[model samples]
Target: DTAVSQTPKYLVTQMGNDKSIKCEQNLGHDTMYWYKQDSKKFLKIMFSYNNKELIINETVPNRFSPKSPDKAHLNLHINSLELGDSAVYFCASSQDADSPLHFGNGTRLTVT
Candidate 1:
């Protein structure tokens, strides 16, 4: 029962609106991350946090921010969402970079 989970499997939103995606993991992993898979299926890391400390922010827009209150929970908040932000957002966790990630099914965000 300890697996990564994200809310709203699909989101159809209007541009400029703000939205938040919540994620939780039950695994004992110390690191949690946010990745975006574009329409082309290319996955890119957006944020990474280890033990509630953010360690990486990969050139993501300022409007997109990730918050991890605890090792098992990380939430993403986007302000003034844009059309270019449309993609599948996946929540993942792993022991470390060398370890394989356990990914959530993903939140398909469509910004109209």
Candidate 2:
């Protein structure tokens, strides 16, 4: 089984449209995270969930939301997408907060 999986490896939408990406992990990890990689390839953590409790990163915009229905799943929702939101979104899971992370292949989002 895949350690981490994300759906819709590619997404293209209008600038003002909203979309969501789904993620799931079977590694039995306790912590899950959502990461965004900008065009410059700078990766930043947007949100973290431990045992289904949310912890948002201060730098993330209010338009981004992370929802964890359970410890093994973390989903990302973007509202009113912008051209600047065009990038790859990654879903990752770690055994613990301090352990190395296992990332999904990533979803490429394009807002035209």
Candidate 3:
């Protein structure tokens, strides 16, 4: 049932607002992660969780928060969105960090 799902494949909003993206996976994997890609398509890790436990936490801003509701769900919450926040947010997972990560199609976040 969980094949890494994220809502709003595309988001368009002006600067200075709050937005949250939802994600869920049914792979029964232990680890889930969030990656952010800039306009040029460079990906960077944002957060990761294993079996509902926080694992990898990247150097993201306080305005950005990632929450894992369980081993099967990881959601991203952003506050006071800025123009720089515009990028692709991808939800990924694997058995562990050493394993290859499988990513969703991606949510294109466009903050104006």
**Strongest candidate by lDDT:** 1
Model 3 stretches astray by more than 4 angstroms: none
Off by over 4 Å in 2: none
Pairs that collide in candidate 3 are 2-26
Task: Evaluate model 2: give its lDDT.
Answer: 0.92
Model 2's C-alpha root-mean-square deviation from the true structure amounts to 0.9
lDDT of 3 by residue, 1-112 (tens): 5488899799999889999998888877889999999978799999989988888889999999988878888999999999989999999989887888878889999988
**Backbone collision count in every prediction?**
0, 0, 1
Worst 10 residues of 1 by lDDT: 1-10
Per-candidate Cα RMSD to the true structure, in Å, reads 0.9, 0.9, 1.2
User: All models: lDDT?
Assistant: 0.94, 0.92, 0.89
For model 3, what is the alpha-carbon lDDT of residue 31? 95
Model 3 lDDT-worst window of ten: 1-10
Q: Which window of ten consecutive residues has the lowest lDDT sum in model 2?
A: 53-62
